[model samples]
Target: MSRARSHRWLRRPNGDTTPRFAYGADYNPDQWPREVWHEDIRLMREAGVNVVSLAIFSWARIQPTEDTWDFGWLDEIMDLLHEGGIGVDLATATASPPPWLTTAHPEILPVTASGETVWPGARQHWRPTSPVFREHALRLVTTMAERYAGHPALVAWHISNELGCHNIYDYSDDAARAFRDWLRARYGDLDALNSAWGTAFWSQRYSDFEQVLPPRLAASHPNPTQQLDFKRFSSDALKQYLVAEREVLTRITPDVPVTTNFMVMGETKGMNYADWAAEVDFVSNDHYVLPGPQSLDELSFSANLTGNIAGGRPWFLMEHSTSAVNWQPINRAKLRGELARDSLLHVAHGADAVCFFQWRQSAAGAEKYHSAMVPHAGADSAVFRAVSALGATLRDLAPAAGAPRRPARAALLFDWESWWASEQDSHPTSRLRYRQEALDWYSAFLALGVRADIVPRGAALEGYDLVVAPVLHVLPAELAKELTAYVEGGGHLVTTYFSGIVDENDHAWLGGYPGPLRDLLGIRIEEFAPLLDDETVTLDNGATGTLWTDEITLTAPDVEVLATYTSGAQAGRPAITRRPAGPGSAAYVSTRLGAQGLTPVLARLLAAAGIGSELPEEARGHVELAVRGDGDTEFWFLVNRTDEPVRLPGVTGDVLSGPTGGGTADDPLVLHPRGVTVLRRPAGR
Candidate 1:
C-alpha cells in the first residue's frame, strides 16, 4: 500500500475549482455566546477567511454526560458557516473528555514514572493504552463523522488534538501490559528480546515477556537498551491510538480527509512524525516561534523538515501566534511586519494553508491572553488589520498555491532514533545535544545563503551533491550500507563527532570508535576526549572547538588532513580528515564548531562539492531565498533576514506580491526591513 493517502485539499462550500490559499484560525464559537457568532463570521469574511478548524477543544461542552450530547449549538454554527461561504475542518472534539467521564472512570488517567496518578485538572490527562478511554473516544468519533459526512461546509476531519503532548509516558499497569504486547510483536520471543536488548548486562535478563516493565523510576539508571525501547514503544502506542480513531473516520466519511496537528517545534520530540506521516490523509503542523537569537532559524528548520516529511507536497500550517502567546515566560508581541513575514515564510516552505491558534481572544480561560486574529481590542486593533492584509496577500499569490518545494543541492540528514538514543544516561558528555548540532549546521547554511534541505534518515540521498549528517550516533547496519553506497555513487558525505558508534540495539561497535564508518571515512578513534564546560581548543584554521573532540588516526593512504588541533592534548593531530572514494569523498569533523565557526569551514566543503549560493554577493547574508514550483514555472520567495533594508541585484522576475519595485541592470531591487517578496519566474532560472 502507499505510504499516505493521495494529497487531498480543502474545497469551497460552493465547490469552486479556483486555486486559493486556505486562510483562517481555530474557530471556537462554543466559547462565546450565540449572539456574538454573527459578528465573528462578519469579521472572518473581512479577513478573507475561507476555512476554519472548528471545535478542537469542545469535548466538555459537546458531551456534558455519558448519554447526553449537545449538538444543537454545533448544528447552528455549521449552518451559519456554510451560509457565510466558509469551509470547516471539523474536529472530532475528543481532545479532552468531559469531567463526568473522568470522574466515573479514574482508571483511564495516566500514571507517572514515579507511580503517582496524574489528575484530570489539565488537558490530555488520559492514557493511550486504556481501553476505557479508547471506547469512549471512538464513540465520539463515530457520532461526529456520521453527522457531518454530507455537510456542505465540511472539508476535512481534524483528529484528536496533538496526540502524546502530555500523556506519552504512562507507567500504569495498563501501559505495562500494552508495552509487553508491543515488545512481543517486535521481538516475537523472550530469547530474541534478550539478545536485542542486551539484557544480560547487570543481571537484568528477563525469563519471559511478563517480566518486562517500562523503565520507570528505578534505583539507578535502567538498562540503556531497555530505556531506548520504552521510548520507541511510547511513540508507537500513541500512533496506534491515532490509527484507531482514523479507521472510524475513514469508514464513516471516506470522502473527507483526516489529519491531526503535529507539534514540530523546539524540543517536542515525543512522537516520531516521519513514521506517523504515512497514516494521515495529509500532514498538518503546529509551530510556535521560540525566543532567542536562533528563533527564526529554528522555525525555518522545522518547516523545512515538515515539508520533507510530506514528501514536498503542500501541507497545512495549523497553529501559530498572531502576536504574544500566553504560554511563554515573557511573551513579547511581534514587531511590525512580523505577522505577514512569518506566515509567508511557511508559504515559502510549501504550506498551502495558513491558520493561527484562534479567531477571537478569550474573555475567560487559561489562554485568554494568547494572541489571536481578533485581539481584545476587536476589529479596530492593529493585529486584526495585519490579519486582513495577510489574507489579501495570500489571495494575490494564489498562483503558487500547490507548488512543491524545489529541491536543493545539499541536504542535512535528521534521525529520530539517533536523537532518542544519543542523549541517554551513562554516555559521553551530558551537554551534548543532537538537535542543536543539526540546527547549527542549518544556521551555517542560512548564514552562507546556501539553500539546504533537512531530510529524514531514510529519504533518498542520491538527489543531492552533498549531505551533512551531524551527531548520527546510531548506525544500524542497513543505514551504514546505504550511506556507503551514496558516497560510492559520487556523493560527498560529511559527519561529525559521536557518529557511527552504536547499532540499533544501542550496543557499541567492538573494533574501534566510529565502528561502521571507520573504513569509509578513512579515520579511526581509540578514545573520545570530551572537554569540560570551561575548556576550549583551537584549530589550525582559526576556529574554536568545544564540548567534545576525537583523537583521529588516518587509516587510508589517500587520506587528507584538512585541519589540525593546535592546543588540546591531540595537538598537531588531525582535527578534520577527508578521503577520496570511488568518484566522491567522505569527510569527518572531530569537534563542535558552532554556526559562526563553521561558516568558513562550510565554504570550503561547499566549494569542494561544487555548490554555491544563488543570491548576489552583497545580499548573501542579508536576504533568505526559498523557491517553490512545478516544472513549468517557479515562485522565488526572498525574505529580508535583518532589520535593515537590503539591495538585491542580479535578479529578474515579475513581482507577484510585495512592495512595488523592480531592479534593472544598473538599479537594484529594494527590500524593506523584515519584508518578504514573491516573484513569479520561469523554471530552471
Candidate 2:
C-alpha cells in the first residue's frame, strides 16, 4: 500500500476517496462509566473530532498487577469509537506506571538531587535510566503493539503522556552509570572529556569514569561545566527512554506514526525536543498559557517552538483547555471568540491537528474544573458550540489544509547550552535570563511581521538571510566557526550583550568581550558597568531604555555608537553598536532594551536584512503573523488579537468562517474581535 503523506497522519482509510478531517481531543474513558461511551462518541462526532487520543494514563487500569495484563475494556472502547467513524491515536499507556510496579520494584523510583527519594502517587515518578523501569515499560509497549498492531482504527501511536513530567534524569546509581556510558560514547576518551569539562580547574580530574556524578541543583558553588553536562545528560537520558519505546512501536506498527507530546518553553522537564524530533514521526506540544493579558505572545511562542521541533512540519496542538484551566491560581474562561481564534491560529502556524486535553469534563480529581468539549452538564455549552462549529469548518476545509505552506528566510538561533551557561554563570548579572532576552528579540521580529525560524546554533546557517543570536553566552566551537563563515558569506548577524563569553562548558574564553566572535564583530571589552535596579539609558534615536546591569564592558574598536547610559561613571559610553564584517554587517546591543525602545530598532534592522511583514503596510495594532509551507504552497496566518475588528487590504478566506467573513479571497477581509484568518496562495502561484 502507498504510504500516507510523509508529514500528515491520514485519518481516512485507504481506497476511500472521501475527504476527511484529522483533528481531535484526548478522551479519558476510565474517568467515566462504560455506559457513557456511546454518548461521548455522539458528542465527539458533533464536535468534529475525527481522531481520539485514548488511554494516556491507563497504565494502572490496564495492568494493575505486575504479571497480569488487560486489554478488554480498551479494545471495546476503540471498537466503539471506530464504529462511530472516529480514528484512534492509541497511547502506549506508559506515562504513569501502576502503583504496584513502584511498590514491587522500588528501584524503579527516582531520587532527586538532594538525595530525596521521590515517592509513589505523583506522575513522572519513575527513574528513566533504571533498567527495572525500562524493562517494565518495554513490556507494556510491546504487549500493546502486539495486541493492537493491526487494529483498523489505529492511526497513530502516542509513546507516552508528557515524557518529562518530573524531569527524567536522576542521580541514582542506574542513572549515574548510564551518564558515564553516554559521555564515553560522545567523547570517546576520558582525556577528551576532561578537557571539554575543564576538570583541572577545581581538581575534578577523573582518572576513572566512576568518579563522575550527575550534576545536582543544590551544589554549594555549582560548577558551570558540571551544570552544562548535567543538562545535556538529562536531555539524553529522556531520549534513551523515548527511543526505546519508539523502536518497539515502529517495529510492530511501521505503518502507524508514533509521537510524544512536548511542553513549550519548559526547562525543568529535561526534554530537548530538537534531539527527540529525529525519532518522532512529528513533533507535538501541549500549550497552556496562563490566563492573562500577554496570553497571545505566550501562545504564539509555544506554537513557534512546536513548529521548530518538527523542522517546519505541521504539528499537533495535543492538549489545550476549551475554557478555563484549573491549574492556574486564577482560572478565567477563554473569551467568547478566543478558543476558535486560537485553534485556527494553530492551523495557520502549521498545526496538522488541534486537540484538547479532554472530551468530557471530569467530575472528580485535580482536573475536575478543567474545561472540556462536553461540559459537566453534558449540554451544548458556549465552548462546546464553538468547538462544534470549528470542527465542521475543519471538515469542510480538510483538503485545502492538508497541504499548506511555510516560507521563512530569517532565523533566531536558540541554544539550550547557551541558556544554561548564561543563567548558571555566577557572574556579572543575577537578573540576566537567556530566554527573556531571546523572547524580546522574537517578539520584536514578530510584531514587525517577519517570519523567523527558531533554530539551534549548530543548525545550518547558510539559508537564513538574517540571523539573531541574543545572549548566546556559550559559543560551541563548531557553531562559532559556522557563524563566522555565515557572516563572511554576507549573512546579516545580530547579537546582544553577554554573547560569546564562554565555550559550551560555560568556561570563559580568554582574550576579550565576546571572545570567540570578537574578530568577526571587531570589538573587545575594556570594562563592564553594572547598573542598579531600573536604571535608564538613552539611545541615539532619542528613546530611553532600561538597564539592570550587573556587568558592563567597553573593549572593542571599529564600532559605531547606538546607545549610551544616561546616568553612570560611563555615561558617554556606547551601549549598542554596529560594524562591518566582510561582505555583510553585524549589530551589537550592549544592554537589554525595554519594549518601546526595542521594537522600532528591530523593525529597522529586519527591514535592512530584506525581511518584511506580509501584512499590508496599513495594518496596525496587536496582529500576529505566521507562515506555513508545503512544497511550493504557502499559507499566511493573520490574527487580530485585539478587542476590535480590523480590516486588511489583502483578499483572504476565513479558515474558521462562520457567518463572519465569506469563504472567498476576493475583497478585503474584516476580522471580528480576536479573529484569525488563513490566506493561502494556490500552488505554483
Candidate 3:
C-alpha cells in the first residue's frame, strides 16, 4: 500500500476525507444537562465546528459499575451528533480509571521517588506498568470499540486522553520489576548491561539482571546511565499501554485510526514522542501558551516540532487556550485577536485541525476557569465571536490542506536521549541547558529570516547543506563517525562545547575534551571554564559570551582560529576553530554565544554552505516567514511578531487570511501588530 493510503483510519473506506482544518474542541456532553447539549451542538454548527471529541473523560458514566455497561446515554449523544451533521473523534475513555476501579485495585496507584503513594483525588492516578490497571483499561476500550464500531458519527478513534500527562514517571516496586525485565530484554545478559553502564565505578556492578533497579534516592547522584535508561523505560512503558489499547481498537474496528493526544509542550519532558509516534495511526498533540518572555517563540518551536514528528504530514491540534488559562501561577488572558492568530500559527506549521480543551466552560471542576470556545459568559461574549470568526477562516483555508513543509536547507540536531542525559545533575555546569542552547541557535536562524528543521540525531544527512548540533552532551560513536563523513562528503557541520565528549552510556571518551570529534574539527579542548553568575568573557571578534567557555587549542595546521578570548585567565586562546575538510568544513564554537554573537558566525556558515534566507528583502526584518509546498502550489505564512506594520513591497498572491496579502505581484503586502497572513502562490510566482 502507498504510504498515504496506508493510513486507512484517516481516509475511510467510503473515501470521505477530513475537512481542510478540523475545528472544534473536547465536547463533554456529560458535563452539561441534556437540554444544554442541544444548544451546544447548535452553537457548534454556527461556529463551523464539524468535529467534536466525545467520551474523553466519560469512563465512569459509560460503565458505572464493574459488570454493567450503560451505552444509552452515549447512544443518545452520538445519535444527536449524527443528526446534527457533526463528526466524532471517539475517545476510548481510558485516561483516568474510575474511582471504583482505582479503589478496588489500589495497586494501580502510582508511587513517587520517596515511596509515597499518589492518591486518587484527581485524574491520572494509575501506574502504567500495573497489570491490574492495564486489564481494566483494556476491558473498557474493548467495550467502547465494539459498541461504536460502525457508528456513523465516528470519524477518528482517540485511544486515550493525553497519555503520560500525570502518570509518566511511576517509582513503585512494580516499576522496578518492569525496569529489570526491560534491561534483560535489551541486553540479553548481565555482562553486556554492566559494560553499557560502566558499573565498575563506585562498585555498582550488577551480577544479575534482577539486581538492576530504577534510579532512586542516592547519596550523591544516581548512576547517570541508569537514569538515562529509566527515562527511556518510562516512555516505553506508557507506549506499551498505548499499544495495548490500540490493539483492542484495531482488532474491533480495523478501519479507524487510533491515536492518543500527546501533551507535547512546556517543561513536561518525561515521554519521548518520536518513539511513541510510530505506535499511533496518526499523531495528535496538545499545546498551551506558556507564561514567559519567549512564549510565542516556544509555541512556534513546539508546533514545528510536532509537525516534524508527523513527518510533515498534517496532524491535529488537540487542545489550546481560548483566553486566560486557569492553571498558571498568574493567569493572563490573551489580548484581542490572539485566538485566531494562535490557531493560524499552528495551521501554518502543518496542523490540519484546530481544537480547544473544551466546547463549553466548566462550571464545577479543577479547570472551571480554563478558557473554552464558549466561555462562562453567554454566547454573546467576545471570546465566542472570535471563535466563530476563526472557524470561518479555517473554512476559507480548506484548499491548502495537506501541503508538506518545503525542504529545509539547514537542520538542527535534536535528540531526546541527549536532552535527558545532558541536564542530569553532577555535570560541569548544571545550567548548560540542552533545549535552550538549541533554541538560542534556532532563534538566530529565525532572526536572520530562515527556516530550519529540527531533525532526529540519527536522521539522514542528505538534502541539508548545513547542520548544527548544540550542547549534544551524549554523542554516540556511530553518530560521530556519520557527522565526520558528512563533513568529508561536502556537508557543513557545526557543534558546540559540552558536545562530543561522552558516549551513549555517559562514559567519557578517555582521550581529550571532545572525545570522538577532536580530529574532525581539528581542535582539542583542555578543560571547560564554566562562568559564575557575575562573570563574563570578551571575545576578540567584538562579542560578549557567558554561561560557559572552553579553553581550546588548534591541533592541526589546516585548522584556523575564528575567535580568541580577549579577557579572562585563558585570554589569547582559540575560542572557536574551523577546519577545511575537502569541499566542506566543520566549525566548533567553544563557548555559549548570546543571540547577537551567533548571528555573524551563522551567517558566515550559511554563506559558505550556499544557503540563504528565502524571505523577501522588504519583509526580512519585520515578518516571520515560513513556506510549505504541494507540487506546483506554495503557501507563504507571514506572521508579524512585532508591534510595527510590516510592508512587503514586491510580493503579492491570493490572500487566505489577515491583512498581509492581496492583489497581484505589483501590490505591496502589509501586516499590523500580531497580524498573520497565509498567501497562496503557484510555483514561479
Candidate 4:
C-alpha cells in the first residue's frame, strides 16, 4: 500500500544533472499575442522560472471544431521554452472539451441529483463516465503525447487538470451504468450486495442487478450504504479515467511521468486522494489558503498530509497563489512576507517544486483577477518582487531539494471514509467537521511545539509512539483488528466521540457507541448526546466542549477518568478518560474541545508518551518547526506563525537561508513578521 513508486523527477530541458529546486508556473501563452511570448521568456529567466505546465485548459484552442487541429502555436512555444532552458509539463488538453464536441454530444454533460443537466459555461463540465467524452479526450491525449514525445522541453505529462473538481458526482445514465458495474465488481453477487447495503431495512432489496441504480433522488433518505457506495463508485470512476489517460501516455511516451493536481485544501474532499496517490508518477497538490483563524495551521496540515501521501518522498507544489485568489468570498491580497512564507512552508513539508496557477494574470477569462507571478500590475509590483525573492531563496536552498520529510514521534490518522460517513445526513450532529477536528489536534501539537505527521488511515503505524485518530467514524473489521494490534504492541491510541460507531458497510457495530474500540478504550456509551448550536459545556480540566458529549461507563478496572463535565446536563461525568494496556495506553475524549482546549489534554498525553517540544519553550506558539533530510544532516524550517516578530532564545544551526539574524545556543534569533528560516545542522545535534 506504499506510494513510494516514483523515483523519477522533472527532466532538465538542457540536461543539467545538478539537483535544484523546480521553480515555475502554469504558462498560458495562447491567451496573449505572440509578442508577449518573448517577453515571458525574458521575465521567466529573470525570476528563475524553470518548468511550466502547458495546454491545461486549451482544449478548445487545440481542437477548434473537432475536425481541425492546431499544433503550430504549441510547436512554437515548445521550441521557445527549450531555447530559454525551460521544461514543460505538457497537458493532454482534455480538461474541458471543445464547444463543438459538447454541443454535438450533450450526453457527455454531467447531471445533478435532481436530474438537471450541468451546463457548460465553466470548466470541468464533462462527465467522468461518459464514453463519448472519453473517446474525444483520449484522441486529444494521444495527439499531444505523440507530438511532444521527442521534445527536449517536455519533462512530464499533465493529465486533465484537477480531475474531479466540479464534475465528481454525476447522476446521468452514463454514471448510473458505471456505478452499477462498480457495484457488481465490489459485491460480486446480488446477495452480497443486499447484505452489505442492508437493503431489507426499507424494502429496498433488489433481486436483479439491473434494478440497482445510483442513490438518486429518493422519497426518504437514500440507503446509507447506497450513498456511501455511490461516493466510492464516483471516486473510482474518476480514478479509472485517470488510469485510462495515464496508460495512453505511458505507452506512447514511456519515459515521461504523468501527474494530475489534487486539491487537498479545506473541504474539497470529493476525491479520495490517498487512493489516487499510487496511480500517479508522483503526488502533486494545489492548495489555496482559506481565510480563517486556523488558516496557517490548515496549510501545515494539508502539506504534511500531502507529504505522507507521497510516502515521505519529495512531492510537487503544483499550484498555489502568489497573492490573493479570485475564488474566495472576499479575495484579499497576501500580506507582506506571506508569499515566500507560504511557498517555503510547502517546501518544509516535502515539495521540491514550487509553482503557481498561472504565470501571467488573465485579462478576459473568469479567472482574470486571480493573482499570478506576473500580476496584472506587471513585474514592478510587490507580488512579482516577492515571487522573485522566493525563487532566489529556493535556489540558495538547493541542498534541501530531494530531502524526505523527517518522521515525527507522533502521528495523526486522517480517514476519508470517516470524513464522508460521519458528516452524512441523519447523523447525531450536523455541526461536526471531521477535518477541523483533525486540524484542531494538529494545531494543539503546533501550540505545544511537538511535530506530528498526518498519515492516511491504512499507512503503517508501527513506528509512531502516540497516534491520534480524531473522529474515525467508519471502522471496518480489519482496521479494527489493526488498531487493537497497534495498541497491544505498545502504541498509544487516542480517538474522539462518534468514532468506531459504524463498520465499512455503514452498519452500526451493534454493541454500543465507539463499538470496536470499546474494549481498548475500556468505556461504553448507550447513546450520543449531541449539543445544539447555542449549547456549551464546561469541563473540569478548564476546557470548553461543544458539538458533542458522551456519558461513559468504564468497563476496565485500570481505566481512569481524566476530565469530567462540570457544567452541563451530564454534570460530574467523565469528559476524558484513559486506559492502560500493558506498556501502552488508549485515551478517549468524549467531547469536542477545540484547538485551545485540546492543548492541555494533548500535553498530558505527550508527557505520558515521553514526547516534548523540539523548539525552545518560549517559541512554542509563535514559531513552527519542520524537519527534512536524513541521518547525517537535518534541514530545520522555522516559520513565524504570527504577523509579529518572534524571538528564539537558544536556536543553533548553520544558517542555510533566512532573514538577517543568526542564532547560537546562547544568542536569540529574531524572525521577522511572517518570516521563515531554514537551518542545516547535524541530525544528532
For residues 6-73, could you state the per-residue lDDT of candidate 4 as single tens digits? 66778775567787899999999999999999999999999999999999989999899878999999
* Model 2 alpha-carbon drift over 4 Å, by segment: 1-11, 15-21, 217-219, 266-269, 544-558, 631-633, 650-667, 682-685
- lDDT (10s digit) by residue, model 3, range 570-665: 699888888889988999998888666898888888888998877776666466677777889998888887777777766677888778444436
Task: Estimate the lDDT of model 4.
Answer: 0.92
TM-score of 4: 0.99
Q: Show the lowest summed lDDT stretch of 10 residues, model 1.
A: 1-10
Over 4 Å off, model 1: 1-3
Q: lDDT of each prediction vs. the true structure?
A: 0.91, 0.75, 0.84, 0.92
TM-score of each: 0.99, 0.93, 0.96, 0.99
Candidate 1 positional error at 5, Å: 2.2
Candidates 1 and 2 compared: the better one by lDDT is 1
> Candidate 3, which segments miss by more than 4 Å at Cα?
1-14, 17-19, 660-666
lDDT of 1 at 618: 88
* lDDT value for model 2: 0.75
